[model samples]
Target: MQQNEFAIWQEFDPHAKAWQTLNNDRSRNIARKLGIGDPSTARECLDCHADAIAPEMRGDRFQISDGVGCESCHGGSELWLNSHADSSVSHNDNLKNGMYPTDQPIARARLCLSCHMGTADRMITHRIMGAGHPRLSFELDTFTWLNPHYKIGEAWTKRKGEWNGVRDWAVGQGVAAENLLEVLTNKSAGWNGIFPELVLFDCHACHQSMSDRTWGPRQGTGLGPGVVRLNDSNILMFRHVLAPIDKAAAARILEQTRGLHRATTQSRDATFAAARRLHATIDGLLPTVAAFDYGPDSLDTILSSIEADADRGEYRDYAAAEQVAMAAQSVVVAFENDGKVDSEKAAQLRSRLDTLYATIKNEDSWSRQKFRAALAALRAAAP
Candidate 1:
């Protein structure tokens, strides 16, 4: 019955709209151009936009119309469905039965990124983006908070321990960085025909208008025009996350991150070698990030590091600036919730945050100068 219960889930799901919008004749134009007869029936389109589970696993009760239901992230409900109903059953027992171990921050992040960040099983190529699919960007804590189904409270804490936004954010960065490296290393999924998957590279590198004359040399890359660069937004944010916990490791990661950018201009072999080294470094730090507690002082330090990055012109692209804006808001909200910021200061921070958000709200008109000024104002207003 759960599988056939479409009205309960699909009626409210935002993902269901992806299928609904694409199945229509008007939206299928791009898909048709790409040789896909009908996006609704196309295997490639169904993989990410809908629940494209194998037919054998999907019983008669299971239905794809329920679009990204509980089973999507929680795993199949067969084993634990009945056992989970018993009040005496502990959370660990339910997990042992079949429930996904989503309570673990890193585990949850990996599950979310499997879809958001793409994987070997489901690749989000540049062709898909060209077919009107929006550019994918995800931060775990932000998305979790945005999800309407659950709340983090006493009951949730009892089941999953205390919810830490900073930890989620940190784990998310490491997971995304790791995922990118894995994608880069995978021959089957990383390459499309003869061209490397352009979707993985920075969009702004080639998507900018011809009239834009703002191209300049970046010390981070040491490369000139026409060279596609690896998207480093996640790695850049991860550096700020590591600064308060381990300054030396953070500096080393930053150096390798720049090295990776430079390697992109050289050859595929060099890029993969550089990515492997950086991935190992990030993997080593994930455990510390998982266990560390982010107190008020640490939050302040992290925010300060982000501000420093902005001042140094590290967030020149809209993608990096958008991530920073979201991270800043998350930190400020967390501080406010913990009573670290007084009401007056909270109001001031919100005003500054509004300006920061406005700067990147419109991608076509996003100005690096306006965003930097807004970021400075936000730092000045921080308590």
Candidate 2:
């Protein structure tokens, strides 16, 4: 019923009078796994693309095919699909004629990063989750090498497409987490659409540990396997990108990497514990800078509060609490910003923050409820 409901990338090759084949079925499987109802439906895929416009009217040219399209990453088969058998059309000719946006390795990385990277073309709304879809991640060569996600058989490999060999998919070269973070950190780059610093931790850093028994019910405690190892190969790559800006962070990263390899190789579990602690610390620090909204506290208040707490110079005791409070406040503000001034979004933000605050710790003296009330008033005043 949606627009472009029938716009799937049909596998049919007109010249051969048969369906074009994919060596691996991962794409089809992922579509089904996403529970999109009908894998063949074009609208479903479009829903995840630029074609799924918001209620707000925008330029008519904003097509969903601009992102996440089969042809967007793969080649547009319109010409080749129908004309490959004309004898006049060679494979190279088909490539020349097709509209494969992600033909080169770096370009392919960029194409996936368009949404996954969470830096480019993000639509902002004032909701607690921020506007638009959250960014995923990118691992250029690694991505193409993912047999479960993409098919890189001889047919695909031999083609001059975006995928480099799987071996090149290592942590070093491609758009790992670190690379995405660099693009995101640059305010001039316009990657502020997604929540900040989320890219710091790997997906498993949150998702896997979320299912762990040791994770408990702590708010913002992080959700995943709680691995102590530095899973954020992206952050390593990010450090390289940011090295030009913050020498301290760069040096610290190098030090951490050296230590991390030793820890991981020694006792994986112990290393995971250390990594979890480190991740928690960094995770707490990131939200303030990423979204830059701290609800009733404001950025100045939040930073001042943290600095004031840290000024006590007691790293072990109450100082850590102060840092956590500041981080929590920042998170609350981010949620509020995500909700914007919309009634529904406001309610969602309020609920998430209140719940997280309650579960994180029982510092009843902080008066989070009072703070929530004040933010509610501000939301009512916002235009």
Candidate 3:
């Protein structure tokens, strides 16, 4: 099969030779699937693989391919070359044709997300974009532009390719959301899965400074890293947005999120202890959430569930949760009452949640760090 002209070529740099050798195998196809390109030579590698340059380690020249390119996620590029260019090719086709494989959302997202989102391994700690290559920001919907060669579509069409964008979003949201929930539980280990939960700790609602703060005693006693204040407002944000989906579950999830936030403020020992308690509750709750049949018809069931259980009853301890539940329920009503969910209604719910989240952050109780962390997820989804 003939390669297209867009297929630029560069001589491999000895420094990058190792990754190049690995990339030269089928992994190159996966890069193409991701909409990134494959180029030889250090300069060209930087051209397509700018992510190679550590944001923190700039100014030094290295042979390692900088930006995550063709071989990074897909595996060695060698075996699939002949079939890759064929119009009949597919991600699974390439896998069958012989390339190290992965199909699960968690695994695949972890790979692409490694460089795309910036994690412990591939920290935002680098800069390849300004080094004369496309920037490495992430948005699952538009990211395919990075791998135009594969042509994954809005819907999975065989001729287009075999990919699951929806599934990716679902699992990514679930995992990322859960990770945030964990960090809200405890901030000291915020970087756990490399998803950047600390960013959520920026309580724009309460904190005067984004990076500076001292919530209370350091976890290690002597004076460890400063703590960020968090609050319960976003806990309400969660209840509002999620309650209409399932009130009892939403309330439970909100309290659990708050519990996680509370954990972050305490010592590691306390945090873990809280985590164990929270995790047990979540273990039972999440499976039930997963089992919910949340199609169009289920909307009424959710609304009734919320209506039957008032805020004064089982969920009295959670103010943020109640407010958020109301906000979320309002959005659901607006959505169901009308055929389409216009931007106005969505924005309204988002604004209410944001205000409530901000209000909680300003409170004297929970750390402000906790409030923002919980709200960030709502902010992303709402607007």
Candidate 4:
């Protein structure tokens, strides 16, 4: 059963093929333009594309072809493999023997974000994106559901506590938000040459067509045209999570987030200061967010917040819209799972979700007006 699950995961895994694909024509073309030759063996590319480990750590049986193998996520099995087989051993004992504590939502999220959100060990820079790498985006609960290899039955829950998607989503947001600030403040990881790593900013800010002249001003920032904004998608989503439990904290976070955006148009020092303040605010909320149980009322609050943001033209940008879609899906699914939505209502909500998802399906053809309309319709149809 374990072997079958592993095969299934690997079959659909992007990480498994990262190395081979990096050597393909498309990646090579981009790499050539960026003066990166043969990314298959390039240290910069290999660090993420292939299994990155020290020479001594990789045994004779170890192969880069395994990609992100069990050891990659679960840690080296040598210490726990024998003891783990004995039924007499406790789960905690296995963990103590070097198994990763992925059963914990926050720990799992941190591990996933190390590569997905980038870290001091593996930083995804502007140059990598310039070489045609896709922008990084992660929501732990959503990703886990999409690629579930293990069933969380009673036996599973006995080993690991009850799995909560809402809790995972909330924890993920805080972790991701914290990671963004860490990268921004870190002198070595944040900067490349003189620029402040524009990749950390919204991709759509500078990627949009020159001919599209429509610019709806946001009152929150009061910023004008041609100003790059920080990618606050995670922070924005995190606010929704906080809204149900602590309205005051949510409002404060929203204010700080807007302040951070406004600071971007000013000096570098201003941006850093604003980011630090906002980061501290989010960091402080982690304990409450991790502990709070998301019930029906909580789901409603989050969904309501998402709708409010949409109405305010916050989802006009592709990055923000994408995050909104994920947030809406997460809340709706949680509501359904908790029996907050009946079968009939679930059907209706699912249809509305499909419409919302369709709006952002095609990035090139994304219409803000159409998306807003779809979102408003979804909000109206919500139970």
TM per prediction: 0.94, 0.34, 0.44, 0.94
Tens digits of lDDT, candidate 3, 165-263: 322333333443444345545534354464334344433233335464543331111222344433333333333334435566666765665565566
lDDT of 1 by residue, 1-383 (tens): 12333453456657656567666776588688788888877887777666778899896788666556677777888888877656688888889878898778899999888878798778878888887777888888777776345556786687669978888888888888899888987888887877788888888988899898987665555567777877888988999889789999988988898888888777879988998999999999999998988777788889889988876778877778888988888887888978888999998899899999999998777999999999889888776
lDDT of 2 by residue, 1-383 (tens): 12221143222212121112111264355445555454334343343343344536434444443443344355546566566445555557776787554445445554555544444344221121222223343455434433332344565555543332321222122243433434433444422343333333333334433444433221112222344323344443333322223446545554554554455445535444545444443344333223222233332333333233233321111112322333434334444544434777556656654543453243323333444443344333333
Which regions of candidate 4 fall more than 4 Å away from where they truly are?
Answer: 1-3
Over the full model, what C-alpha lDDT does candidate 3 score relative to the true structure? 0.43
lDDT of 2: 0.38
For residues 1-383, what per-residue lDDT tens digits would candidate 4 score against the true structure? 23356776678767667777876888788778778687776667777676778889988898876767777778888889777656678889999989999888778888888888788668888788887887887888888788666677887787767777888888888888888888887778877777887768888878888998887876445567888877878888888888888889988988998888888777778888988998899889998898888876777777788878776767656877887787778877887888877899999889988998998888877988888888787777776
Q: Note each model's CA RMSD in angstroms.
A: 2.6, 21.6, 12.8, 1.9
What lDDT does model 1 reach? Answer: 0.81
* Model 1: worst 10 consecutive residues (lDDT sum): 1-10
The top-ranked prediction according to lDDT is: 1
